[model samples]
Target: MTTITTRTVEYPADGLTMTGHLALPAGVGRRPAVLVGPEGPGLSDVERRRADALAELGYVALAFDVHGGRYLDDIEEMLARCMPLLADPDRMRGIGHAALDVLCTEPRTDPGRIAAIGYGTGGAIALELGRDGVDLRAIGTVNALTTGRAGEAARIRCPVWAGVGSEDPIMPPAQRDAFTAEMQAAGVDWRLVVYGGALHAFHHPPVDQAVRPGVGHHPEHARRAWRDVVGLLAECLPVTQ
Candidate 1:
């Protein structure tokens, strides 16, 4: 196994002191960087492990925080904060840009080559960054099929890939259609994969805390989604040896 390094990084975003996880690949020389966004519940060990996995693949990865350093185990509290934030594009962009700035400033990151991959609310932020005209190599989102303001998606300069569970009530067929319609209207390169029989947040591992209705983990689909995102990165942002 390739040796990788990990650290905790503190940065300010959305008026909160965010603590993120940064993972570096072995023997890196300004490697391509990736931004990993957490779900609405906030950053967890799940996201940190993903950053480490990406680092092992020779990419510098940072798993950014959403609720300062706290993880919201209560579903109601998570929605209370995420609902309003999701409705505001500017706020999402601010958070994304803050994390991007930290990633760019890292000595191991190649600023010119970066991709944003996020889950849930974090996924929405990644899409917001694309809509805000960030020069990203690619954008990958899971279970956050949000549509931007009218005609704003045209600002997205990179290809986008999204994954969602077919049975996700939060992102039902109607919502997915709306999101895809917006992407199509903007002429953005986008793809959506619906995992059959999976529920909302299907990619997440089983949690000990009580989850919202229609939120469940599908271990098989979760692995598939990870491979799909990694495949998206390999195709759009190849790492040079």
Candidate 2:
């Protein structure tokens, strides 16, 4: 197993003191970095584990915070905060950039070789970072295919990979169509993978906590989707020894 270190970090964003979890592979000069965003609920053990997994692959990883360090167990609360924020691109950019800045500040991070990936609301924030024209190597999002304001052109320069569950009601066909159209119109090198018979948040493991309707976990698709995400990252931001 690779040696890795992790710690909690506090930073400001969206008028809140956002807390982030950073993971680094042991014994490293500057390395490619990845910014991970958790689901709408907030940063949890899952996101941190993703960061650790990235560290194991020899990339400096930062799992960013949302909702002021509070995990929204209540679906209503999650919607209340996420709905409005999703409508506001500028706010999402602010949140994404704040974490990006923190990730860049790490000595082990090769700032120019960074990728962003997220789940749920965090996925939307990742997409916003791409649309906001951040110089990311790649953008990978799962279960957050929500479209931006109409007529606003997306300025994503890097390749983008987005995965969605076919049965995800929140990101149904219409939303996927819109997202694809936007990406195509922007002339981005983008691919969308749809997992059959999976629901929203299929990438996430089953939780005992309250889950909104139409949300379920699929172990098989989850694994495959992760492989695709890693492939995208390896293609765009290869980790060097």
Best by lDDT: 1
Best by TM-score: 1
Clashing pairs in 1: none
Give the clash total for candidate 1.
0
Worst lDDT window (10 residues) for model 1?
Answer: 204-213
Q: Per-prediction TM-score, please?
A: 0.99, 0.97
C-alpha RMSD values across all candidates: 0.7, 1.2
Which digits, one per residue and each the tens of the lDDT, describe model 1 over residues 120-181? 99999999999999999999999999998999999999999999999999999999999999
Clashes (backbone N, CA, C under 3 Å), per candidate, total: 0, 0
* Cα displacement (Å) at residue 168, model 1: 0.1
Whole-model lDDT values for every prediction: 0.96, 0.90
Q: Residue 54 error for model 1, in Å?
A: 0.2
lDDT of 2 at 60: 95
